[model samples]
Target: MLTPLQKTTIRATVPALQAHGDTITRTFYARLFAAHPELLNVFNPANQQTGQQARSLAASVLAYAEHIDRPGLLAPMVQRIAHKHVSLDVQPQQYRVVGQHLLDAIAEVLGEAATPDILSAWAAAYDELAALMIDTERDLYHTGTEQPGGWSGFTPLRVTRLTPESSVITSLTLERPGGEALPPYQAGQYVSVKVKVPGDDHWHIRQYSLSAAPNGQQYRIAVKREDGGVVSTHLHDRVREGDDLLVHVPAGDFTLRAGTRPLVLLSGGVGVTPLLAMLHAALTDTPQRPVTFIHAAHNRAAHAFGPEVRALAAQHPQLRTLVFYTDVQDTDQLGLPSHQAGFITAATLKPALPLDADYYFCGPTGFMATVEGILDELGVPVTRRFTETFGPSQQFILPAAALAAPI
Candidate 1:
């Protein structure tokens, strides 16, 4: 709880904070690393250099200040960050260092404008926010203890299979060392895979969503070889069965919200990975729930899980599947061709999709942006639309109040 004066000061300072957030966060990270270089082991250098981590931190801080009077509003965002922190192994004492650096950065950036009242308010706010995160992370850490087959950080697992699905996509089967039980994960959650590439001093971490419901014996993840991308190229060419790998426990907030509402699942390119898991869950767990699963691929050579999807749709009476090809011949004669030859837009969505159904989407930024706009135009409630973006996220423009920054 904040006093009225404190809240006022914090609110008054938000414009400056938002516009200069990246600047402040960068300064804080520099100072922290200069003082405690060991912290580098916990942060992804690529993410830091790309400005993703700092921007995410800035958004979280600004959101917390906005919702100070109603802390519950921050729950979803906090939980997501908690999972990231756990994967990164952020310790309790690190929060204090972070807070100090944050305050110092603010003072340095604001100079004379940062009066006593404003500084005090921000200091209190940072402490409260940091405490909230530490407590939430601790609770999650404890929860993992009581949960069956749970582990704190990434554990060394061995790859059992690297079955190819297409030219670019392959299915990976991983099992715990010594055949220990694996933790169950929700359909759309993703796990981080850490690997060290040649000539790299640090490890690379990337997230891949599960491609199937828990199969009891092995966990399945689908990877799309990114040709020139570091982790993807290694996984495609060098990684193989019997290779030891490190994988963090599954974590994400994009899982299906339990409901009886008619459901529509959409994906493009490799985005189909998570939705495939959801579709499998729907078949086994909620067979009667109305579902329209849509997938888009660049061409036949790029399509993944085509045979499996066809089989699932054939077996389940309630499930409807559609594929759109951006570069397939109009008269092409594939035996199991249920595909269209265009993009998925509002007009295309209307015919096959129920008007009042829950929508879930995952894909490249362009695909999601187009789909979200179509859904909004169709008047779908924000709550009914669930989406996730993999890899680096899209940038967010600072709010209008952020005009105070000269740059």
Candidate 2:
């Protein structure tokens, strides 16, 4: 436990810390890579180029300082980052080195403002925080290691089936190369897929959330073709079943919160993947919990898992499903009340949502931002708004090098 004085000191210094957090994180990563280039195998260079890794590091530091007094208060944030760390193959010993770099970066960035007292307090706080993280993550790493096909880092797996869901989407089933069973993962977590694209200098790694409940029979991932994007386009154009692909262990904290509160699942297009798992878990594990699903797709053809979602809704009395067809034939349109003609707006959703409900949403950034803004305007508490950003590249930002690099 931190002393009262220490707590007060941390609380006051947080703004200072937040102001320089990104700078320190930036410096820390630069120093870390300079000292330990081998760690690059665990981190995605493209994400680094985009500054996502820096923001991730910065968010952790800020969250730690913000919740220094009551460390337990940071449980959810800790769980989220721990899963990311595990996927990155972050080890306990790595924390000490990271701590050293972080402290050094802070002192360098803050200069005279980082007094011995300030430095000491932060060091102690980081040590305490890191200990908690290490303790929490060690169990996860152990549980993962003990699993049949799981290992400390990336391993080779063969794609078993590549079933195309639509013109732009495909569902893949993968298994360990030796027929070993892989580690079981929670519903909405993601796994890192590393592929060596032809004519590329380095391997391209991306994350895709698991699309189904873990049946222990086969792990599944749904990937969408990105015509304008590099890797996704390659996966769609060239990737095939029976081909070997490298994958990191499953990790993420976007799993469903077990509670009795009614769930309002809002998804748009491919955003349905993670929520599909959540919906599946809700149907099987917590069937009594009321769930209302609202999905928006470009058209019927672009709608992924339409039949399965309908089947689940049909089977569960507590489930209410609504779909919005952004594109449909005028002649065949049902013109149903639940079937909205276009996008899902606050007005369209008002009838389906309970006055008091816990909402979970997943979609493109624009869609999510729009819904979040609408929900906020409608007086939804921030705590009740749960969301997940699908696909890789963490939170968005442009790295210094990328800014300097000529187009």
Candidate 3:
């Protein structure tokens, strides 16, 4: 526990953190990576390139400062991050490296203005937060190991099947070397796939959601090829069937909640991967659960798993599948769109959805924002609404403290 004076000192730094948090975090990461190059294997370079990782770190630090006294507010976000850390097999030792560089970065950025009291208070805060994360990740790591067919670290799996789902997305099936049984993960969980870049000793690790139900035979992941993405490019062009790749145990907290409430699973573009798993899960586990699977894409040519969703909806009356084509193709639906013409908005969706339903949505930032607005306007309880973002998440924006930065 920090002393009252220390807490005050810590709270005082919040303004500077809010003003220059990204610069501090960017410098911290650069220094950390320069000191410990081996960690390049753990963090996603794509996130680094896009400044997502720095921004995420900056947000987390400011959020912690905002709610330092009432830590309960940070619990959910901490749990979510702990699962991600567990997927990368992150250890407690790494936190020390991060903490040291972070403090050094603040000192460098603030110059002579970073006082001893402020630095010490920030150090205490960092230690407190790191302890919480480390403990949570430790429990997560242990839980994954204790589960059936689970292992501690990276396990080698052979790519058994490769099939293109759309022009840009491909589904790859992975199985253990000798047809070994893999651990079963929750419907929306993901595994960290480590790829060996050509001529590089260090491997690039990327997490992909398991796009299929747990069948005990193989785990399937849908990967979308992105422009200038290292892991996606490697997986799309270099790797093929019969090739081997290292993967960590599946981990995530954005899972389907168990209840009798009607399920609304929505997706956009390639965000459909995890939601597709949840859809199949509802089919096998809860046959009576009413499900509405809505998806939005640029056009029919970009839609993945369209045939499967259509086939399921055709056979099952309880399952309703709706597709929205923002840019309709000439060959799509006899030169027409599917159900809707423009984006999936409140005007287009308000009539079909039940207010009491359990809503699970995954999509880009704009898509999630739109869904959040629609749900809010419909007066759906916060308890029933769940969402997860595809790329760098912008989900939780902490209540900002209005304070001006000092010179």
Candidate 4:
């Protein structure tokens, strides 16, 4: 436990943290990789190169300092990080390495400002946070291993089949070589795929949402070919059926809640993967429940699972799907029940959406921000709106009007 002086010191450094957070994180990563080059195999090179990981770490550190006394406020953030850590098979000892480099970076950046008292306070704070994370991850690891058909760490699975979903998206069906039953997972959970690219010395790991509902026989994940993405490009261009890949147990917190309220799912681009699973599971479990799925894509060619979603909608009267195509082709059919040109706007959503429905959306940062703002304008309660970002934790900047409104 932090003494009163330490807590006061941490709170007083909030401004400095905000100002130098990014620099500190960048320095930390540089120092960490220099001293422990093996860690490169465990982290995303793309995210690191683009500075996304550094920015995310910086934000997290600042938030932790600001909420040191009220740790309850950090529960959501902690849960998200813990899940990600477990998916990566992060070991407890790595925290010590990280803490050392982080503190060194802070001191190197702040120079004289980082006095012995402040440094000591920060070290104790890091230990406290690290202990919490370690405990949470231990519980998660236990639950995952204890579950039926679940295994700890990465397990090798053979890719049984590959199906193209769209111009840029493809689905890979994976199953155990021994044809054993697979563990069940929540509809929106994701699994980390670990692979060593042909020429690379290190491994690359990426998390893809399980695009299909649990079948107990196999697992399906949809991969979108991202530009210059190491794992994605390798999966799209080189990985093949009959090939084996290391996959972690399913883990995530962005899942569908069991309830009787109307369900509204919104997605942009490849974010539709998890929402698709939720739709399938929800329909199968509660066919009578009303569900509205809204998806935004570039065009018909970019829209995945279009035929399957349309077929399901045709078969179920309670299901409604609305597709927004930003760039409609002349060959695309208009006036269809599911087709709409342009992006999702308040004008389009207000007429059909239920105010009391549970809203779940995932997509590009801009798209989610817009959806949140629109939901706020529609007077949807904060508790009913849920979202998931694909990569790093990006803060959703609400519109000016929405910010002014009461929570």
The candidate maximizing lDDT is 4
Off by over 4 Å in 4: 396-407
Clashing residue pairs in candidate 4 are none
Model 2, 213-256: lDDT tens digits are 98776788888886465667877878888988788888887878
Candidate 4 lDDT? 0.90
**Which scores greater on TM-score, model 2 or model 4?**
4
Candidate 4 differs from the real structure by a C-alpha RMSD in angstroms, to one decimal, of: 3.1
Q: Which of 1 and 4 is the better model by lDDT?
A: 4
Q: Candidate 1: deviation at residue 236, Å?
A: 2.3
Instruction: Note the Cα lDDT for every prediction shown.
Output: 0.79, 0.78, 0.85, 0.90
TM-score of each: 0.88, 0.82, 0.93, 0.95
Candidate 4 lDDT over 1-407, as tens digits, reads 89999999999999998899889999999999999887876777878998888988988888788778777667778888899999999989999999999999999999999999999999999999999999999999999998998999999999999999999999999999999989999989999999998899888788999989899989999999998888889999999999999999999989998987899999999999999999998899988789999999999999999998999898989998999999999877867967899989989988778658999999877888889889978888887887898788855222344345553
**What range of 10 consecutive residues in model 3 has the weakest lDDT sum?**
398-407
Model 3 bad stretches (over 4 Å): 334-338, 395-407
Error of 1 at 317 (Å): 1.8
Residue 402, candidate 1: Cα error in Å is 25
